[model samples]
Target: MDDNLKKLIPFALKYKPNIIWNVVFNVLYALFSSLGFVMIIPVMNVLFGEEEKVTKLPTYNGIWELKTYLNDTLYYYVNYLTEQKGAAYALYLIISIIIIIFLLKNLFGFLGLQHLMKLKTGVLRDFREKMYAKIVDLPVSYYSEKRKGDVMARILGDVNEVQNSFFAVLELIVKEPLTIIITLGIMFSISWKLTLFVFIFIPISGLIISKIGKSLKSQSARAQQENGYMISVVEETLTGLKVVKGYNAETYFKNLFTASVNRLYILTNKIGKKHNLASPMSEFLGIATIAVLLIYGGTLVLQDGSLSGGAFIGYIGMAYNILTPAKAISKASYQVKNGSAAAERVFEIIETPNVIRDTEKSIAINSFNDKIQLKNITFSYDGEQNVLKNFSLDIPKGKTVALVGQSGSGKSTIANLLMRFYDVENGTITLNGTNIKDIQLFALREQLGLVTQDSIMFNGSIADNVRIGKLNATDEDVIAALKIANAYEFVQHLPDGINTNIGDGGGKLSGGQKQRISIARAVLKNPPIMVLDEATSALDTESERLVQDALEKMMQNRTSVVIAHRLSTIQKADVIVVMNRGEIAEQGTHDELLAKNGTYAKLVSLQSFES
Candidate 1:
C-alpha cells in the first residue's frame, strides 16, 4: 500500500498473466508445505501407538464431514498395515508420503519463483524504457538546472536500488503471507485455542521489528542523495581532468570527493545496522513463542489428557514452520522501506515537466521562405536578468548576416532562440511570416542547420557521425559533404576512409579536424538556413584558415546567421551587426562600419591592437 509500490502498478499490470501464474504456484507451494508438516502426525502415530486402532474401513462422507472422513481413512490403513505386515511397514509408508509432499512443495516453490522472475524483470525493463524516454525528451534547460551525474544516478543506481530493495522483496511479499496463512490454518484445525496464542505472538513480533526500521527510509534517502553528489564529483573530475591537472587542483577535488563518500559511508552503515536487526529479532521472538507453546501443549497432553502426543507434537512442528515466513516478511518490511526511498528518486526524473515542447495544434513546415524574423523579443535564462531585451533581427533568404559581440553580449542566445532551444519570455520568431511557436518543434528544427564552437561527436565511425545530419544519406553523399567542408582529403587518408572510428567525443582528432567533420554534417543536412556560433575561434592559424574556408563554402546560397568573436571571419558577410549589452550597437557592411568608427570599428581596432 506504499505510494512508491504503486508507481510500479502501470508496469506491473502489463504482466498480469505472470502475476496470476505466480499466485497459483505460490498457493500450491503454501498448501503442500503445510501439508508436509501435517504428515508428522501419521509418522508419530506409527512410531508411538498414540492413535486408536481401527478394525473396519471408514465410511464415505459429504464435503462437510470430509475432515473426519479423511482422518479415519488414514488411521484405518495404518492399523491394517501394522497388523498384516509390521509397525515398520506403516512407518515406511508415512515417511514416503512426507517425502512426496515435501517434493511437491519444493517443485511448486520453484515454479512460483520462475514466474516471479518474468514479472520482476519485465516491470524493470518497461520502467527503465519509460525512464530513458523521459530523459531524452527533457529540454536542454532542465540539464542546465541539474547535474549530469545526479540524473545518471536516478537512471542507473536508484533504479537498481528499486530492483534490489523493492522488487527483491516482492517474492517474500507474495509467498510468505500465503505460507503463514496455510500453516496457521492447519494449526487451528488441530487446536484453535493454541492457534489463538500464536496469533498474539506474530503481530507483537511484527510490531517490534517495525519499530527498528522506521527511520530506514529517511536514512536510505540521504544515502542515495549523497551518492548522486559523489557521482557528480567523479564525472566533473573526468570531464575536466585537463583543466584540473593544468590548475594543479587534484588534491582539492580529491578531498572534496573524499568528504562526499564519507557522508555516504556513514549513512550506509546506519541503514545496514538497522536492517540487520530485523532477522535476529524476529527469530528470537519465534523461539520465545515456541517455548511458551512447549509448556502449554505439554500440559494438555500429559496433565489433562485432552490432546494426543502425536497431535501435540505435530502442532509444535507447525508452529516452528511459521518461523521462516515470519522472518522473511519482517525483513522484507525493512527492504520495502529502504527501496521506497530509491523509488521516489527515480520517479522524480520520470515526472519532471518538459516545458520546451511543441504547442497543441502546432503546424509543421517543410521549407523556409522569405526570411526568418525575431520581432520585439525579450528573454532571460534566469527570471531576474534579461539576456536580450526588445531585440529584433531579420535574416533574409540567401543572405549571410553576422553578429559580432564580446562575451555576454547575447550573440549565442540569439542563435538558441532561433533554434527554439529556449522559448523567449516575450517575443515572436517567425519563419515566412508564420510564428515559429506555432510550428511543430521537430519541423522548425529540421529546417535549420547548426554548427557550434564545440564539435560534439559520438564514439562511432566517421561515416556514422556524418549520417546523423541526414540518416538516409549514402556513402557518396557523405563524401561530397566532407569535400565541401574541406575534410574529405583527411578522410581519404584514414585506413578505413569514412568508416574510421572516432574515439569518445572525437578525442582521436584535433580540434580543427573535429570542427570540419561537424561542418560536413551540417552540409549534409543542406537546410535553407545555417547558424554558425563562433565555429573558428578555438583553432590554430592554419586550422582556422581551413575551417574558415569550409564555413564560407557551406554558407554559399544559404541564409546564414553567424555569431562570431573573430572579425576576420565576417568581413565578407552581406550585413554585419555589432551587439553590446543585448542590443545592436551598429549594423552595416564591414567598410561602412569602419567609416562610422563606433562599436564595430572599435572592436576591429582592438583585434588589430592584439594582432
Candidate 2:
C-alpha cells in the first residue's frame, strides 16, 4: 500500500492547485457547519428563558478576548431587540441568523465537492494517457505472456476504481478529520468532561473498523483480478467468434465466461458484507456514547445545577454531529484499502520497465545506405530452442529478396527480428554496417514499411486510415498512394469516397479490399525498405492478382523482403532462400533453384502440382 501511494504522488503534485482548493474549502465548510450547530445555543437560551440580560453592548476586543466579547455581544443585541421590537420579532431575528449560517455551511460544502471532482477526474485522465503510452512502447513479446483483456480491464475498469477509492483517501485526509476536529472543539468548549468520555469509545470502534478494512483489501483485490479474467474471456470470444461458431463451440465459451463471473460474484458478496459492517457498527457505537453521556450529564444538571438545560442539549447536538463524520472516516478506511489494491494493479503496468528501450548512448539512423544484415543469428521466442539458428541474410538497397518455406521455418521470424520486435539471443543484425541495437528504435522503424496478412485496420474514415502512414499527409498524397496500391477506384465508388467510414477492424470491406488499403498505407509511408509478410496469401485468386500487382509497384526501387507461401508471387525475386528447421536449405533465383533441384525446386514443383 505504501508503495502504491508513492505512485500517486506525482499525479497529486500535478494538480496541487485543486488540492489546495479542496483543503481550503473543506476547512471553511467544517468551520461553518460547526458554527451552525453552535448558533443553536443562543436560540435555545432565548426560547427556554435562560437568556442572560445585558444593559449595554460589549466593546471590541483583541483576538484573545474575542470569545467572551462575542458571547456578551449577542446577549446585548437580543436585549436591545427585545426593547425596540417585540420578543416575537427578537425570536424571529435569531431564527433568521441560524438559517443564514446553515446556508453558508452548505454553500462551502458544495464548493469543496467541486474541487474534489476536479482532482478525481484529472488524476484519471493523467493515468489513462500514461497507460496508453506505456502499452504502445512495451515489447511485442510482453503481450505473448499477457492477456489483452486483462490490460484493458486495468486501463478502464481498474483505473476507475482507483479514481473512486483514491478520492476516499483524499476525503479521509482532509474533509472528515477537519469536520471531526471542528465538531469536537465545540463539544470540548461546552463540557470537557463529556468530551473526554466520548473520546474513549472512539478508539474501540476504530480498532474494529480497521480490522474489517484489512479483510476488505484482500477480497477487493481478488474481485478485481476476477473481473479482468472475465473481461479477457469476453474479448477472446468476440475476436474468435467466427471460429467458435464454425466449430459449434459457443457452449464451451459460455461455460468459461460463466465460471469467471461466478467466482467474482461469490468474492464480491463477501466483500459487500465486510464493507457494509462499518456503517452500522460505527452508528451503534455513536448511539452508545450518547446514551452514556445522557446519564452522566443529566446527573450534573439535576443534582448539582452545574450545567444548564439548553447548553446541555446543545452539547448533545455537537456530540451527535461527530457521528456522521466518524462513520465516513470508517467507510473511507475500507475504501482506501480497496483502492490501494487497485492502485497497485494500475501502477504495475505503469511502472513496468520496457525491455526494448533506446539507451542513452544509442544513435539515430535516418536512411538505408547499404544493406540490412543478419549475421549468423541465433534467436528464440522461448529459451528452449532457436527459431533461427546460425542463419544469415543480407537485403541490399533497391533489391528484392524472398524467403519461402513451410510454416515455422523462420520466415516470419526474420521479419520479427529485423523489426526488433524481439532481439536476437545470439549474433547481430545490422543496418548500413551499424548494429541495430545501437540505433534508436524509432529511427530504425521509421525507415521501413510493413504490410502483413492480417491487414489490421481501425474504425475510422478511409483517409484517416491511409493518413496513419504519414500523419501530415494531404488529400492529394493519400489519393496518389491509394492509386499506387490500386485502391483509389474502389474508394472513389464508395458513398463518401475517401471519407467513407470503415467499420470496426475494416469489417465493412472484403479481405482483399482491406489488404489493398493496408498496402496504400504502406505506399504513403514510402520507406526505403519494405516488408511484405504473406501480404496476398489470404486473398482470392482475382484479389491476389490485383494485390500482387500493387505489391510489385510498392517493391520497385525499394529494399524488399518478401515472405510468401505462393510460388508464383516471388518468381521474379533477385534471390530466393529456402528455410527448413531453423536453417537455410537452398539459395538462388527462382529458375536457378529450379535448375539446382534443391528444397526450393521441390517446393516449386509441389506448388505446380497443386495448381
Candidate 3:
C-alpha cells in the first residue's frame, strides 16, 4: 500500500462494522452469481437429453463423495419427473431455480453497494470536517500567503475526488476481487486446464493496467492544481469586480481566466485519456483470453472428450463472468491512483503543525488586570525585513493609547501581537504580568474586542451579528449594546429592526451603519481591552462623527489601543504614541506632543491641512 492509503486507514477503520457487512454481502453475492452460472449445466443436459437414466435413487454418502451423490440424486429426480409427469415440468423447475439464484445474487449486490455508500459518505463528511477545523485553527498569517479560492478548492473539490477514488478502492479491494475469486473457483471445478490458461493472461492484463494507473496519479495531481488556480481566478474576479470594471481591465482578467481554464482543459484531457484507457485495455485482453479458451476447450471436447459439452459451455459462462470484475478492477486502479493524489493534498493540510498553539503549561486568563505590555518585540510577517524592530509599548488598564503613524509603520502589528494573531520573534507581550504566549489563546482573546476599518459582517440578522461577540446575549442585551454604540435608532428603522438580514458584509447598510454595528458587537462583548484599527478612517464627515462618538463611548474606562490614520480621531486620547519606520519616535498627551514639534505634530498638521 502507498503511504497515502496508509494514512486513510483510520478513517476507513471508523466504518469497520459497515465494511465487514459489505464483505459478507459481497461473498454471498459471488456465491449466488457462481451458482446461477452453474445451473446452466443442468439446463443444457436436459435440453440434449444427456442426463443419465436412473434405475434407483442414490443412497446417502460420506462427505468425500457428497459432490457425486448430490449430482446423481438431482439427475435421478429429473429423470423420474420426466417419465411420470413431463420434460416440460422438469425444464420449468430448473429455469425457476436459476431465476431465484439470480435474484438473490442481485439482491446481495445491492446490499453490498448500500454499505459502501454509507462508508463513502461518512468518510467524506469526516474528512471535510477535519480539513475545515484545521483551516480555522491555523494562524492568520497562513492565509496571507494563500489564495482564498485555492483553499476553497482543496476543501471542496479535492475532498470530492478523494471520496470517489476511495470508494473505487473499496470496490477493487473487496467486491471485485471476491467476485473474480468465486467465479474462478467455479471455473476450476469445471476444468482446471482452461482456468490455468486464463491465469496466464491475467498477469499480462494486470501489467498493462498497472502501467495505465501509474501516469494517472501525476496527471490527476496536475489537474487538481490547475483547478485550484482556475477557481482562484474566478474568486479574484468576483472580489475585485468594481476595480475590474472601473479600470477597464475586464479583457485582461478575462484573458487570464481563459488561459488558466485552457491549461486545465488540456491537463484533464490527458488525464481522461489515460484513465479511460484502463477499461478498454482490460476488456480487450479478457476477450483475447476467451478466444484462446475457445480453441483449447473446443479441441478438448471434440477430440479427447475429457470435458462434456454442457460443462464446457458452463465453463465459458464462468470465464466470461471474470471479464466484468477484471474491467472493474482495471477502472478501480485508475481511481485509486487519482484518489491517492487527492489524499496527499488533503492529508498535507490535516497533518500541518499549527505554528501558533497554546502549550501544555499555558495559563488561563479569567479577567484583564493591570495592563498589556509589549516589551522589546521584534517580528515580521515573512522571515526577512522586520515589520516591528525592537518595538516596545505599554498600555495601562482603563487608559486610551492611540498609535499614529503612516501606513506600514507597525501600528496594527502591535494590536495583532497583543491578540496573539501572530507570535513575536523576540521578547514577550504580557497581559497582567503573564506572557500572552503562556496564556491560553482563546482565554486571552476573550478578554479583548476588535473593530477594524472594514466592518466584517456575516450574512445574518443584525442581532445575530452582534451576538457573535457574546453567543448567549439576550435581545435586551443587544438593544442596550446598540444604544451604547448609537446604532439603535438606525437599526430600529430597518424593515425587521435587529432581525433584518444584512446582505453579504452588510452591503444593505451605509458605511457608518456597518461601523456602528461593529462597535455594538464590541460593546456587547464588554471586554476589558479593545483594539480599534482606524475605526472611522473610511467614513465621510457625518459617518465619522457618529462612529467616533460610538468609539468614544465604547472606549470609556476600557484599556484600549487605537491605531488612527486621521489624527482628529485621537486628539483626546490619554496618551498618543507616534511611530516612525517600525520604531516609536515620541509619546505624550496630544497637547503635550504638540509642544515637542516632532513627528506627532507634523502628522497632525498634515491631517488638519488635508481635512
Candidate 4:
C-alpha cells in the first residue's frame, strides 16, 4: 500500500498547479456551505422575534480579531437593511445570502472540475503514449514470452481504469478534507460538546471502512489479470480462425473461450460485489451515527433546556452535511485502492527496462560499404543452447546469398541478428568495419528491407500500404515500384486501383496479391540490403512463381540474404549456405552442394519427392 501511494504521488505532483487550483475552489465551496448552515441560527432568532443584539461578542487574541470584525460588519449590514425595509425585507436579505452561498458553492465546484479534467486527461494521454512507446522499444524476445492480448489490455483497459480511479482521489483530496474541516469548525462554534461527539463517531466509522478497503487491491489485481486472459483468448481465436475452421476445431475453441469468459465472469462479480458494498456500508454507518446523535442531543436539550429547538435543529443539518463528505471519503478510499491495482499493471510496462538500448556513442550510418561480416557469431533465444554456434559468414555489398536448411536450423536467426532484433551473444557483426552495435538501430533498419514468408498487410488502400515503405514516396513512385514487383496488373484490376480499400490485415486480397503488395512495398523502399525469408513459401505454385519473380527483381544489386526451403529458387545464387542444426554444414553454389552429395543434396532429394 505504501509503495502504491508512493507511485501515485509523482503523477499527482506532475499537475500540482491544477491540483492547487482544485483545492482552492473546494475550500471556497466548503466555506460557503458551512456558512450557509451557521446563517440559519441568526435567521431563526429573527423569526422568533428575538432582538438581534450581541449579548456576548466573540473575542480573540492578536490577528484572530479579524474574524470577529468581519462578523460585526455583516451584523451591522443586516441591521441597517432591517431598519430600512422592516423584518420582512430583512428576511428577504437573509434568503439572498443563502442563495449567494449556494451559487458560490456551485461556481467553485465547476472550477475544481475544470482543473481536474485537465489533469486527468493529460495524465491519461501521457501514460498511454509512454506505455505504447515502451512496448515498441522492448526487445522482440519480450513479446515471444508474453501474451499479445494481455499487453493490449494493460495499455488500453488498465490505463483507463487508473485514469478514472486516480481522478477520484483528486476530488477526495480537496472536497473531503475541506468539508470535514469546515463542518467541524461550524459545529464547534455552535457547541463544542456536540462537535466532540461527532468527531468521536468519525474515526470509529473510518476504522471499519478501512478494513473493507484492505482486500480491494488484491481483488482488483486478480480481476485485471482475468480480463487480460479473456482478451488473449479472443485475440488468439480471431487470428487462428482459419486454422480452427479447417481443422474442425470449433468446439475446441468454444470450450477454450467459454473457460476464459467464465473466469472473467466470476472475478468481475467478486470485484463488483466488493466495490459496491462500500457505499451501502458507509451509508448505514452514517445513518446509525445520525440516529445516535439525535437521541443524545434530544436528551440534553430536554433535561437542561441549555440548547434551543432552533440550535438543535441547525446542529442536525450540520451533522448531516458531515455524513456526505464522510461517505465520499470512504468511497474514494475504495476507488484509490482499486486504482492502485491498475496503476501497478500500467507502470510495469512503462518502467520495463529496454534490453536492447542503443549505446550513447552509436553513430548513424547513411549507407552500407564493404561487407557485413559475422565473425564466429553465436546466439540463443533462450540462453541454454546456442542457435548459431561459431557461425562465420560475410555478405558482400551488391551480392545475393541464400541459406537453405531444415526447420529450427539457424536460418531465421541470421536474419534476426542482421536486423539487430537480437544481438549476438558472442562475436561481432560489422558493416564496413563498424560493429553493428555502434550503429543507431533505426538508421540501420532504414537501410534494409525484409520480405517474410507471411507478408503482413494492414487495412488500407493499395497506395497507402505501398507508401508505408517510404513515408514521403509519391504516387508515381508507388506505381513504378508496383510495376517492378509485377503487381501493377492485379492492382489495376481492383475496383478502385491504388485507392481500393483493403479489408483488415488485407483480408480482401488473396495470398498471392498480398505477397505482391508486400514486394511492391519493398521495391518502393529501395534499400541497399534486402532479406527474403522464404517469400514464396506460403503461396500456391502460380502465386509462388509471380512472387518469386517480383522478389528476384527487388533483390537486384542489393546485398540480399535469402532463407529458402525450395532449392530451385536459389540454384543460381552467388553463394548457397546449407545449415544443419545450428551449424553451417556446407556452403557453395547449389551445383557444388549437390555434387558433394551432402545435407543440401539430401534436402533437395527429399523436397523433390514431396513435390
Per residue, candidate 1 scores C-alpha lDDT tens digits across 328-418 of: 8888888888789999999888888887788787999889879988998899999988989899988899999999988999999998989
Candidate 3 ranges beyond 4 A from true positions: 52-66, 609-611
- Flag regions of model 2 displaced more than 4 Å: 54-65, 83-86, 609-611
lDDT (Cα, 0-100) at 231 in candidate 2? 93
Weakest lDDT window of 10 consecutive positions for candidate 1: 164-173
User: What is the per-residue lDDT of model 4 for residues 1-611, given as tens digits with 9 covering 90 to 100?
Assistant: 34654576676678889989988988898888887877776576567654245434445555657656656655666666667788788777787888888898889889988998888888888878878989999988888889999999999999888887777877777787888798888788767777778888888888988887788788889888888887888898888889989999999989987987888788778777767887788778777877887887887778866676666777888888888888888888888887889988888877788877788999999998789899999899999888999999989998899998989999999999998889899999998889989999999898889888787999889999999999899989999988887789889998998989998889899888888888889889999999888877767787777767777777777889999988778876899999988888999987787889888889989888321
In model 4, the clashing pairs are: none
What is the alpha-carbon lDDT for the whole of candidate 1? 0.88
Q: Give candidate 4's whole-model lDDT.
A: 0.83
- Residue 53 CA error for candidate 1 (Å)? 2.9
Error of 4 at 114 (Å): 1.7
Ten-residue region with minimum lDDT total, candidate 2: 602-611
Please provide, for model 3 over 90-116, each residue's C-alpha lDDT reduced to its tens digit, 9 standing for 90 to 100.
889889999999999999999999998
Query: For candidate 4, what is the TM-score?
Result: 0.94
* lDDT against the true structure, each candidate: 0.88, 0.88, 0.88, 0.83
> In model 1, what is the error at residue 251, expressed in angstroms?
0.7
**Cα shift from native, residue 177, model 3 (Å):** 0.6
Residue 117, model 1: Cα distance from true site in angstroms: 1.0
Per-prediction TM-score = 0.96, 0.96, 0.97, 0.94
How accurate locally is residue 569 in candidate 1, as Cα lDDT from 0 to 100?
Answer: 90
Q: Would you list the clashing residue pairs of candidate 2? A: none
